[model samples]
Target: MDNLRLNLGCGGTHHPDWVNIDFAPRQPGVLGYDLGREIPFPDDTFATVYHSHLLEHLPKRAALPFLRECFRVLRPGGVLRLAVPDLEGIARAYLTAVDAVARGEADADARHAWMVVEMVDQLARHVSGGEMLAYWRQKPLPAQDFVLARLGAEARLAIASAGSAPLPPDPAAASALEIGTFRRSGECHLWMYDRFSLLRLLQEAGFVAAEPVAASFSAIPDFGRFGLDVEPDGNTRKPDSLFMEARKPDAPAVSGPRVVQVCMQHTGGAGSAAARLQQGLSAIGVPSFLYVSSSAGHIPGVAVIPAASGQTLLREDDGRTLTHSQWPAFVQANRATLARHTHRPPGLELFSESETAARLSDIPAMELAQIINLHWIGGTADICRDTAFLKGRPIVWTLHDMHPFTGGCHYAGSCRAFEQHCGNCPQLGSTDANDLSRAQWVRKMTAYRELDITLVCPSRWLAGEARKSRLFRKKPVHVIPNGVPTDVFRPLQRAPIRNHLGIGPDDFVMLFGADALTNRRKGFAELRAALERLRADNAVSGILLLTFGSNTGPDPASLPCRSLNLGRLSTPEELALAYNAADCLLAPSLEDNLPNVVLEAMACGLPVAGFATGGVPDMVEDGRPGRLAPTGDIEALARCIAALRDLSPQDRALSRLHCRETVLTRFSLPAQARAYADLYRQLLEARR
Candidate 1:
């Protein structure tokens, strides 16, 4: 502990004198560790430590414990140095620029714009890079000298490298939700800190004599020689950062309260939303756990619930004759009844209950959780039976659809029975007053009636639906849009992806995706009609249709254009490839709660042409990035698709940027996570 050094969250800087660790290391020998998590080192191990530009990414609640962790791993008399964006300095600059702008000074307007982005972008950016990145990458960058003065060497190097480097092969295509997860995994700033807050945090973390230092003047022995904070040109590595140092004071560390996000599959909208919330919470210093019916467990802090009776259950519809373990006798009995009762009209949208209840409440993680959030729990949790386990906890349920508030329907498409008592169910073609839908509704009422639960819906339409439901009409409902990682699903060079896909540069490629395109609500029928209209108009000659996901009814080749169906794009890179190669995405779903495709496509700078129904209006602004037609209006949809395809090159480029901007500002994972964290805090306070 006397002479050893540690560099935590070391992005690119490395020294032979120090042990380097980062969440995403850019160099060899730099350990990859989640920065806000517990440090993997013995107590009193290092003589000196440093972390740069990391403190602000942590939520204020988590910063103290993280500092305390640094204090604990550090030896007595050792020094801990940290650098963060100088909030006070930025505010002062912002004010000065405002005054200059008011006086109509030269470059003041540009300076003020940058100052505003500097103040707001990182904190508010839902997508990776956000508005600041957009600003930096602008051609003939605005206010170049003023920007360079504030951003210093780092920005210059990035801008220089970007300008000089050829557009290389994109290696970013990786995961389905890769874009929305960036800031939560440590790229975005969660909370800003000034000199005062910095000192207070260090002191609270059990440090002593916490004081400011210039990058060239660290208290660490011979620190100026290392060039860790200061560059060879004598310019600070991060000019806007406030560098500070404090002593260990022989202290220790611990962490804050815990949370668990309970949800269904990890692949769909609800699961992805729940997973992102957990990620956001984890980033901000809360190690929020995820409890799911089943998962790949790729996410940190995820706990896949054990199968029923310790045996993996093969879940199938009522006609299924095989499984690894037979579902519970009662479950099988219920499935048989549900099958017999469903003598309804065909073409209804459904991917019915996938799993039987697993007593996840008995798990250790559940017991340790101070709060439990439920999302898309259909078929996974027995709402009525699981009430006993869920009752004592602070419960939050996020509606992925109308399922939670309705009688067994994930979407009550054209069915308003849920608003009443669900009698005379049209889904079942039953006219009986005491039909199965009514029975299920009664059970839901009994389960939810007295339970203390808060509800969240991702779209305003869904929020209104939940509020209108008899079951949740009295429950508190909040609207928080879904978040997707923008980094993975970002703008890519169209030429390379098109060439690789054997597509001519002049071809108009329209992409469409969904769980199962055969689902009537996914609007494949409507989409086909629109495509046929384009064919009749001779607009399909240069068009290539790209479709993904399972299609059991009609093959994609049956569409009106030359078609390629890349069934179920399995990787983030693959999705990125599809997005980059396309002229526009056709999200023709008639009913959806903020479909991930719209968000992901926008994030990738691919405009979306879809029906202006459900949450589509929330995403697609006609003539901005994409256009929307009246739902079921094939002529209007064809016109809308053509409108997106026919944009002038200049307008198209701006639309692409605007598409990315829309998601970055509205549906970032961190923002959703912050909102949930705030809600959780309020609930916890009430619980206490």
Candidate 2:
């Protein structure tokens, strides 16, 4: 926390407690800066920004933009207090002086004379110090106390200096250039402001709750400590100033950098991870909005993109969208690309090259987002098709898989084609170098070339793979593991929960979960083979498998052991229960990014027995937290599972402690949010 307060054009009101800034820079420790230039600070860096008697120095045309600059630097809900010479107060004082003069009060003419000079001299003055300086030097000053009361400490000091300093450079002898230079030297007020007009000005600059306050009144804590407007003796420093404060609103702007995350849905691994990241950001004082394909329930700051009901015309110049009546034809037309792959192999990973109908601009929050976060936006090709909507916004795209870099495939598997140009893709079953995969790779890479996207991978394996690809080889890459809610996923009373789930206290239960068990990438086939081997070995007994997720895949009952299918554990509580009831999580994914199941289970104090693929090595190594074997090796996988089952009571508990500690220190959502907050600031600090 470098001082979270900013003082613009501090002049003589410099404070050690504030980040004092002045155009003149005569004061020590004050940053010499001009209001017209962009402030060399990240967005929402300060909690409060203050400037005294500085606004009137700016030309009327530049005033609103200058206020907007104040808004940009102040955090949301932060205070922006400014002091300017009040025109209304001057006029009322002038009228009161007139009434006093009419009543023939002593020094009434003196009071009126000072008022006229105050109101007109600042605007019409040409020479430095002007007529007001001459009045200060008057031998028997007209209304001397009234002038002190009106002008405060600055005038008293100016008056004291007038007697000691010798005047030079007669105005009559000055050249045209000398006079021009004097006018721009900030000796005169370029504009005036009243409370009423200032309120409107603040509102136009995107600030709310604008109102006038006393010199001693402010939302800033210990504002008087700075002694900018009031001295310790309780006398005003600049009594003619009117103080006002306005709040920087919580809009698309950042107090913590408003984040807009784009995800396809809010379920499954990618969607759930995206939603959790949003919650993480919110928990860390960053306001985040989620743009999903479709939202189910009402969640604050979560918005849905309109579902595509119409088809896009294939013809470039056609400019026609299909109607509901054309659903049959639309479906047929969409199948045209995949129709060529009629001989495509089955039992493999899912391949999608389809371009989504909804564009990134379709999300209404796009125009307002200060920082755009892209996550698992598969099928939403329009997000990258023409990234003109994302212009001027710092973008962070989280790599859920290889989808962001590869051609039409989430995982390139053994194909190194993405390292060059994706074509003749094994996943897409393409033979031609100029196939659909290459065309899509070209399309996506061309769009990416125009964007300054920073890629974030949850797994080091994914990041390394992303670097190998031509699409992201030049992009800045970061490894940020998917965060788990430690509070929700912490270890629970195991024996009681195990009894409730009909598992014996002595049973060796292993948990398994995924969107689908039949998905080849999940390595369910290998897990099943390994489980059969474990059942045959008398060394491992009391085998009980607790599985959750869609029932569409192969039945868990076919595991050659007792099994329970907790079909679709939709809530964190359900997932936590599954983690609690198990001795360890069985993750058999042959190819994947950092799986959310592994992170969640580990957070719940459950070790993992899985293949050493993707980011698994990052989490576990030879029972450090869990046991891992070479990927896709059934015998090695079975050995890993057996190693977990044979652990002594004390060893098992120690392993659980390791799992919990690993998640608490590395994978907690708060830590994830803080990392992202810092990264966002870094991006904004070096904004393109």
Candidate 3:
């Protein structure tokens, strides 16, 4: 009896015994067209459908649709078998080798395992929870004996020399080679992850029940005895390679509320979000913790589990700390850090002096309410070894910048190296700048793929960039602009501010600052040129150019005007006065992420004139309260300055009122807080 079995995405490797199919019809015995375009077959056409090594290559936009197609074509009680590389298996193999290498028993298999670990680590850089495993799939088929043998010359020389140990594996080496590094049965495999993340992705993809099809029967007796059950399938006659059986139920499953823990390096952006979220949960009474690195002191309300408090204190210096847990994740994260750091100690110790970090908890399938990830894993290659941290959590990443996405640069202004995968960073003067380190952005991206996480970008520009990133492409992304406390920056009547700043009524002040005068990205050069053009205009008079920053000499010596260097004013009120006293504010930045000063300037009723770069447009209204020059155009900037000089007192006053109103309506703290509240409620309800 033909049970109506099928093979999907068969590029030329169709099983002769089954109803074979291919997206490309040119192949022989092609049964259908593109899996993404449409499912050509009828509903319940096959009782069992199988896919091998084809899932990861599909762009995220098409993955879910393909899954639905597969489901549509299956019988009610039919099985859908998906055979992909097991990230958990590879991660386990890599970790075992890492453990052995640490113990000083680095054999050929151990060395090969370490190299794979390095590759996984490199891919995990810059991302949070499950990103690293998205485009790449991990499989723990037998290592290529031929490749393992090739390590002999490189492996033997290092082993023979006692004083000269082998150079550690290059984490970014995979990025240097094309995708197909080691092909197994015609499939090109890229990365591997742990069990937790893989399971999370399956569940998130609408799979009702995802059961791991064990390959334990083929495992060595020693490995098989290590708490893994060996089961044999009579029909397939082969060990299922990390396959899973998932179904879409008629109705969704209900999950309970959970406790989420967020650990980060510091108390800024990421940690602050965690803190705010905890406060939100506290309002409704959900358990949450925001943990930060401490030099010595602990935050009052936050539960401070000191690194010194952990069972194993790995490294302790330079604002870094790693501790062990009752389980493996914390240990792996720390052990990797210790090994990497100890092998190459720097001028300063990297760990914090006050506390020890904790390890991953032993619990499996944690009903975590949410995950907040903001730790900067540095440019070392050990973060991949610590995938257990996200085992049972639904992650939420607040990407402040592209640092974790692009090999550790706070700003990836012109570098697209991260687009392919980072290594040999040109910024680092390294040949493999494009490589993402195990502890760098690539690894973070890889790890982000495996978690059921929602990604949050603080600025629209950042959010857009995150969409282009390989790690964040699959996740639900939201953009929530940063907010400011408007009451703090409220406008003071101009007369008193002018009096306090000792400015006469007749003084026409042109204000600019919050940037080094010599920096190119700030458009200081254009400011100087515009000032010269303003000074030369016969209609303008008594112009006092008030600048706040380093009084680097003007870029253009031709500009003739009285210049004041307020030089980094400390007080906000003082800044407010400067804004109020000025006839206009000038900003000419090349790139910005919702700069606070622009909003502050508007809130203080100062007219702004600048380039339309980044989030500056969200703040400046072209010809209303202020003028925005064409991006990078100095001539247009000069015209805006002249226009401001011509504005009547009543018109200027109206512009100021409009500017203030824009902030109150769109960018105030209350509005921002409300948006977040709505988002949180919506997300929570969806899960329910």
The candidate with the higher TM-score, 2 or 3, is 2
lDDT of 3 by residue, 88-192 (tens): 655556666667767777364635544564345434432221222221222332243322342323323332342243333444454533333322112223344
Count of residue pairs whose backbone atoms collide, per candidate: 7, 0, 61
Which ranges of candidate 2 are over 4 A from the true structure? Answer: 1-254, 306-336
- State TM-scores per candidate: 0.61, 0.61, 0.48
In model 2, what is the error at residue 612, expressed in angstroms?
0.5
Better of 1 and 3 by lDDT: 1
The all-Cα superposition gives candidate 2 an RMSD in Å to the true structure of 19.9
Worst 10 residues of 3 by lDDT: 347-356
TM-score, model 2 to reference = 0.61
Model 1: weakest 10-residue lDDT segment is 318-327
Assess each prediction's global lDDT (C-alpha) against the native.
0.76, 0.79, 0.54
